[model samples]
Target chain A: MTTLPPPSPRKLGLVIDLDTCVGCHACAVACKEWNDGGQFGPLPDRDAYGAEPDGVWFNRVHSYAVEPGSDHAEGASNRCAGPDPESPAPKPGLTVHFPRSCLHCEAPGCVTVCPTGASYKRAEDGIVLVDEDKCIGCQLCAWACPYGAREISVRKGTMQKCTLCVDRIYNETLDEEDRQPACVKACPTRARHFGDLGDAESAVSRLVAERDGYALMPEFGYRPVNRYLPPRPRRDAANAPPAPPREETLDREKLPGVLRWLDRVLSR
Target chain B: MRPTFSILCFTVLSGIGYGAWFLQGLAWAIGPICEAHSAASGVPWELCPVAFWTKAGSMLALLFVSTGLLCSLGHLGKPSRAWRALSQWRSSWLSREGVFALLTFVPFVLIAAQEVALWIAVVRAGPDGTVALSGWVSQGGLPRRLLGFCLAAGSLATVFCTANIYASLKPIRAWNDRHVVPAYLSIGLYGGCLLLAAMTVDRSMEFRDHRILLTGTIVLAVACAWLKHRYWRSIDAQSSTTTGHAIGLESLGTVRPLEAPHTEENYLTHEMGFVLARKHSTKLRRIALAAAFLIPALLAVLTFVLPRVYPLTVWLALASGIVGLFVERWLFFAEAKHAVMAFYGR
Candidate 1:
């Protein structure tokens, strides 16, 4: 039952705009508030009042200091610096706030790795979820997830993860605008956009194309439905073009007409 | 990779248990070959009485296995829902391991039951040796060869499943390697041979050529020791991952953690962000190897030279071997670096 489903037409997911995210953690808090009262309600907590407080939450945010300029290990990471100079020579690092959650991968190892028919992906919306009733809580799904999406709750005796707000997203009773995920609704900067990514013409899909949105850890080949729109290049750096390649044929007029014709055909 | 006690206990006990079973099976299967060779040599050789050794060895393996399984039960959050673990064998290695482990019990139970019945038969035939129920209860001879085949197949497959469970995990670089499966197989075999030699040398006075058994064990120990050393060395040589690049911020230069998601350690940190100190891990590695391989091999040689101290030597060897396995398994979990650590600055 944990077997992956065939490719779905409606790959409903989020497109997080990293450039606009203020690292407020509003969405993260709202996610907990909404989910704690939803179907997978009241996320388990342990020693809440004790010295070491621990609990299960669907979303978490990480803050990273990114070093700008050269020495980019990955090709995708090479980008020009920001235009606004805080100083004559500013530090080469920019603070980046990263939010971590389930990617709703096309080939989710968490689902396949579950020994029980608990973890599953809906064919209709491609939202990966867990059935608490069926989960044995072996934590194998947690072990398999590269994104650290799954969380094991000792109190509930089950593994919990991002449900993509299935209950709220499809609820007919709620206002149409408020029916989206708690995280998206809570994002004050409007950095989070949710829609069918599989539909190439969808607003989210178009945003992805325009912003050059990319999947995280594409090398792992999970083909995550949720895409992240990378932070934009710095203002001045975006406009500045580095030294361009020189013209190979400096003396175009000096070349023989026959040779020039041959050259043109070869270049074409 | 937090070195949880339940999982550590499970791997240590089951690894040794299954390893011993594999050896027992090998001994049984190869016994006939030895006999034939002896016949060709015109020595009219006699084999050490393996009936008692086989029985005792199988029981010891079963005891360790049962205890290991019980320990794993505590690790699971929903123990009552444990039955659901067997439902996904088609895609899950854990399920395959569970199914294989259950299948393996059949052979162990059969062997243990037969051995017990044989002992009971011996007890019933009083000093006079003629008070027994004759051939009724002792109908068939212990089917060592057939049962040995079952033991070998079942135990090895189970170990493979265990190894694959870790090897298939793409997140942990240390675990998701070609070396993992072979390492598990090697360590399992090494542990088994150690247990077999310990039990055999301790319990037997009839084994004429203790040299052969001891020598084989010594070789395996030495080889296993070298393999573990190389494994540790290789892991050390590898460099840290380019995390700045991994998080899609490489162009920004170096990526460093500015703040963690939580003020205190959370589940992800507790579970995946384990980092063992280099100096301490190196020391532990040496200690584990010394106990598991070096000491056991030396003890085997010592027994060969001074058969009088055989009991002390073999028991000491067994104790040390078990301790070594615990350390080895602990390191396997503790030393592994998870990919999720890229975000947490592990």
Candidate 2:
């Protein structure tokens, strides 16, 4: 009987700070650039300039206007709401920008459903990957996933997903500073972080403790490796600004000719 | 999920094949008799309507079923490695399916051989259309009986295998229930009835048996419709496991994401997080009905009403029914909501 190798203990993960995020898509672009050039083949784009545009990206950011009453904004007060003393008004709505990617769950459903054993979690870091040579393009694993993490590469007829920049993270050639994921390195606001989540004393672990981090769709029980810090609430309603006037009432007529010309140029 | 054509064809084609085979077997077992007379009176003994129609129907059904089974194997990346699938009988339903499907081939080939041999013998015997076989012969009476048993057993086993494949998925709430077994079996029954009707029309057989088959089809169709409706409704009522309360603080009665997890779409978003509006689902349901049940039922009725116009009606019904069943199967997979969907914040 063949004895299976014991699973490795390394648990790589991401820690995201909701408080500092500016919602810039630099991380997404950086990820695309890195993953597209790495060991995995190029991610092809279909009808990029057409009416229906679709392509592969390792990271995607979503903007949500969360109300104070919503569950996602439960602990956090609305930043849009004006700070007022003794006012019974509910917290004003705030636009929360969230970035989403594969959680690299502990219990990955995508790995198990593969009929050909093409999809498997790495014993070293628990990173899920598809062995393209062994994959028949059946896409059963895509159906089995709850996170919608897997996408069928139309060109390759094989499933593709976020690799967490696997080649870069483990490369011995790269310096320690350059070893992090492309997304983490490119994050403008330092919102995205990468480290070993399994280590309690790790920076990601400390951030998780201090910030009350949350997991996306924890109900899936996949136990994603990524952690998201709840958005920090803006204190004091007195510091808030009033709503902007309607567009029709704006004083467009008072603008000078040069300013109007500049405005038109900027608008275009 | 990314739709795999191989699997789609397998389910639809196999469904048609099994239906035809089962009905054909039933017809063979129960000789045709007049409903009004309660006897075989006035029925042409030489024609043997049920036997003739069932045999013809099953032949046609086998063509599609065999092709479908073969095509599904193409989905594997390493086709040669497919033999390994049979090794995991205890844990994997997919492995079990492969074994049963492979086993089915033997019986199907034997039955076809037996039927062809019998036909050739009949032709060689001339005008009497009679051929006698001695028990002592190796590939004669005993072999034929063994082949028949294999065919029947294999067909039933295939159906069971297909059902178990879906039923085994514990995470898919809609597929995991007890209803899956009966629903799959009924689909087979409905398919058999359609094939039986086609064969009867082709052979210009008696109208009475066609009527019984049509009635059976309608009953099965209605039962399927009810079961599907109930399954959808039940799923809708169930609360998601990932409730706002589960996360700790419950100030908000309902928790919805204020911001998505990412700016760029990831693997999870493309997979389990698919959302189709209720309106579109209803529209698709109507289309499925028109394709799968309504048109076929009407055709079956028309075939009974105008026996001389049987050919057009039978062919049209079969074509429409096959297409309809395909759409139905597609929806079966598409509409099924997994418990894991709750994790995607669906």
Which candidate leads the pack in DockQ? 1
The alpha-carbon deviation from the true structure for residue B321 of candidate 2, after best TM-score superposition, in angstroms, is 3.4
The DockQ of predicted model 2 stands at: 0.13
For model 2, the stretches where C-alpha displacement exceeds 4 angstroms are: A1-9, A47-53, A70-93, A198-203, A232-268, B1-10, B22-51, B66-99, B120-181, B201-215, B235-277, B280-291, B294-320, B323-327, B330-346
lDDT of 1 by residue, A1-268 (tens): 8888888999999999988988999988999998889988779679988888888878888888776545333332323343433323435447778888999999898888888888888988899999989988889889888788888886898889988999999999999998899999999999999899999999999999999998887767778888888888766675587979887755657789998788789878
**How high is the lDDT of residue A80 in model 1?**
38
lDDT string, candidate 2, A1-268, tens digits: 0011244566787888767878888888898888878887588767756665566776776555444465334244533465445544454355555676677877676665555566677877877777776666656566655555667776676778888788899899999899999999999999999998878889898999998887766655667778888777656466778768867754657899998888789979
User: Could you estimate the TM-score for every candidate?
Assistant: 0.86, 0.72
Least lDDT summed over 10 consecutive residues: which range in candidate 2 chain B? B243-252
Predicted candidate 2 versus true structure: per-residue lDDT over B225-253, tens digit per residue: 67666766775665555523332223324
TM-score of chain A of each: 0.80, 0.76
Give the local distance difference test score of model 1. 0.79
Error of 1 at A241 (Å): 10
DockQ score for model 1, please? Answer: 0.51
lDDT of 2 at B83: 65
Q: Which tens-of-lDDT digit does each residue in B1-346 have in candidate 1? A: 7889999888888877888888776665555654554556564332224444555676788787778777887788888998888899998898888888789888666666655675676677755574343332231223655666788888899889988999898887778777788888878887777666666634444353244557777988888787777778777776655667567766557777887888777878898877763437978898899998889889888887778887788778889988988988899889988777787777
- Candidate 2's displacement at residue A62, Å, is 2.0
